[model samples]
Target chain A: MNNQLLPERTVYLVSDGTGITVETFSNAVLSQFDQVRFKEIHLPFICSIEKAKEAVIKINNTANETGYPPIIFSTLVNIDIMNLLKTANCIFIDLFGTFINHIEQAIGHKSNNSIGRSHMVSDSEKYRNRIDAINFSLSHDDGQFVNQLNKADVILIGVSRCGKTPTSLYLAMQYAIKAANFPLTPDDFERNTLPATIVPFKSKLFGLSILPERLSEVRNERRPNSKYATLEQCRYEVSESEKMMRREGISWLSTTTKSIEEISTTVLQEIGLSRTLA
Target chain B: MNNQLLPERTVYLVSDGTGITVETFSNAVLSQFDQVRFKEIHLPFICSIEKAKEAVIKINNTANETGYPPIIFSTLVNIDIMNLLKTANCIFIDLFGTFINHIEQAIGHKSNNSIGRSHMVSDSEKYRNRIDAINFSLSHDDGQFVNQLNKADVILIGVSRCGKTPTSLYLAMQYAIKAANFPLTPDDFERNTLPATIVPFKSKLFGLSILPERLSEVRNERRPNSKYATLEQCRYEVSESEKMMRREGISWLSTTTKSIEEISTTVLQEIGLSRTLA
Candidate 1:
């Protein structure tokens, strides 16, 4: 009841681009503070002085209402707009402003100081590569297009609902890595060998396993009351898949409590593939 | 040739967890220096003193070989390990070390001082929500599942290869929004109306568009020499789709030169949906 009486503090994510970078960075930092009940307000594309002034008004209003100043994490590139935002009644943490001049001194050059440089289509080749990677992951999802397995940077093998698809797509979308995923069905377990097509790319194979209880829960969402969703069946598949992975000497991780980002990072590290943003 | 002769400068992304946030922050900051060509090296999972020592060796080696110090962007939470890293022979930019103190002061409390708190599965409910959103987006891609359009936060409609699939997936993956995408076909263009299944949820509709020349180029990569990949057909489909979207009073944007982040941001802003991280 006392917690409920506390007013929610405001945290503004201000950026001249999509605010994606600032949001990610802020989440990483703010997640460490568990006591503050933060209400995030995104002020994206604040490219002009007018927009900055408007954001200032919003920030000041929130501070007035909450009786506590808002915390603003801004990544503005324009000097004039940033100066305007700095005047707002808040704890202004300028992300770019804090680091840009230091980087300039170290690199011995001036920054481009352009708006939307981080998440824009400045390099057409890299943009096309990312699109192609996404298309590849889509077609190759769930062993759909096994014919192009040779082009994949990593082949993820796992039982159904073990988080193969999301991990593959994340690797492709964020890192521009062509990741193909294949499910280990009952037949593969019976045969007691890796999938024939994926055997050729053994060096790039990564396996995902999950806790049987959790796997059954995830499967029940797709097909309730079916044998596939039974706890016994999930246990069987997970054990067999682990055995197969061990026999094939493929690096594997349990995805029972891991996020997609964690799984993708582990997969890239195990496969010795350094992440390259598209 | 002179540009090629310049030695590739190293930029180390050091973090205690998956390093996703640090990589993103580094990219956003380093992208401003268009003149410096950086070679990124990931030193993820650096939670131990041993790992931090190894990173110092690598940074020093790189500095010795290149005759210039590398730029190290780190987000380590361990004060002891971070202090050790500060002794390395490089331009150290401590991401967390720089701002965590200020945030602690402003919030009037001590941080939890935990490792891997951001990208880890710390919140099980939010993690499940993200996984569920990904599954929903995958099932609804290219108009596969229309029965649950009412449950979606946003529905993206556009001509084939006009950047609907990637945009939809990015929204789900990054923002944990239930985003469904439907491809506008020639038949829809001939009929001159939105799809019947999507008409009921007109308020949730958002559209994406692309240049005909770019659309043709993207399509040709998939199905070469087909009528669908021709410039004329792409132009017809794009123009008709735009007209239909305008007539139906749906907000839309051109994705021809936009990144997935940019397109997703615009869609969320236009749909009046505040991005909620699951």
Candidate 2:
């Protein structure tokens, strides 16, 4: 068997959230190597100190079985939990280590505590920017906020029904960005004016627009019988969104249609927020 | 200001499906260079022939605007579509080149003739294994074939409330593993034996066991009032599941206190999938 060719190993992924992103990262990175066979285990939703210890015990047991060693991938693992993991017979790869050091160096801020996940909240004030970005999307419809849009971490203005929600969520989850999206509406057509609020943020403003037919199909799924779902209506909306963006000199994207991941990464790349979300 | 310092570039991430993965790659890689100011225009749903032309138009416009010339970070962009963007004033970074070359050389496969967003589904049988791996995650909850346990890319055998579903889905999506899960019901625990069909696939098997308290909490979330969520019941089930795994010589992971990402990544790293998915 190939088992004789490769050594057996174990890997543990620890995280602040569900370890979803960390898992994805670990899989992507480790899959590059095929010479080793690993035994993987998921430990989700361990939100306290006692739970971390429980994990440590299980990991210790796993190491004993592997007869070799293990690799632990942890994201935002509390120091106490990390220490507990240290007791296990293996190597630990902490993703948060560099980030924490970056944060401390970037802000010259000393962490208030060293034991728990509480340090993440020390800069709670920055979270409002993300909330505001969400609120900005909710309040600003289409090119209305085009001019002030420069304030956005990443301004994603798209045609109605373009895959915006998923892209936004992906960016937020992956890179911790304040991604704000505003959809181009019918009114955006007649006036074709970039919103005053968006004027200041114009530099940061980016757009997402899709094809008429694609937009219609997506809309039709939600409201099948309405004129809004009709091809003619879709054509008009697409035209208007395009015209409005052009009039305001706002260059936007056409998701008409791209996969959510594609659009998200593209958007993150275009705007400076690529660094934030990635 | 710095727009001139690092000319805003356009990186195309063309894909079928959701484009979530490749897009993240583009963003992550690019974001590392803080000095690079790029204007990303993501084209999703490039699977369509029509969307191909539209993508070209956007590429043209962005290249003209970003005067220093744009850089297209394209993933899964149709080569035909590339024809349109090729003439645009930019440097294109093609993602499919290496992958396609690798496949052609290794698998002797004829690439699929379909349009824009289609992944490299080769016409040759040699590449079928890779395609199977890629599409593995799409079919989950195929509960009809418990007897076909051997067919699974990965089989998760664990007690209930041990983070199985999410873990299964993660494996499928990340590794394209057709993961089928069978919960070790209390009856099995009481009997201390695995399902009869799982005996042959013991090598491909993985077990998840959660600590009694954690299992109780997880179960409580679904069914708040029950002996099933009780610490005593959890202890009994975990003990029985462990005993069965030990008797069968199947390796198991403890889900009692780890995150799902950690679990899935551990598996991906252990079994080895692909670099990008990790």
Report the CAPRI category for model 2. Answer: incorrect
How many residue pairs clash per model? 0, 41
CAPRI-style quality class for the chain A–B interface of candidate 1: high
Residues B1-278, candidate 1: write the lDDT tens digits: 45466446789999999998999998898888777788999998999999989989998999999988999998888889888888889999998769989988988877888887899998788888888888899999999988899999999999988888988889889988999998889888778778888999999999999999999999999899999999999999999999999999999999988899999998988899988665
Off by over 4 Å in 2: A1-106, A110-257, A263-278, B1-144, B269-278
Model 1 residue A150 distance off true place after TM-score fit, in angstroms = 0.7
lDDT of candidates 1 onward, in order? 0.90, 0.58
Shift of residue B239 alpha carbon in model 1, Å: 1.5
Lowest summed lDDT over 10 consecutive residues: which window, candidate 2 chain B?
Answer: B117-126
Deviation of model 1 at A220, angstroms: 1.7
lDDT of 2 by residue, B157-248 (tens): 88876766556654554444667777788877656677766767777777888888878876886689898888898898888888888888
DockQ of each: 0.82, 0.06
TM-score (chain A) of candidate 2?
A: 0.57
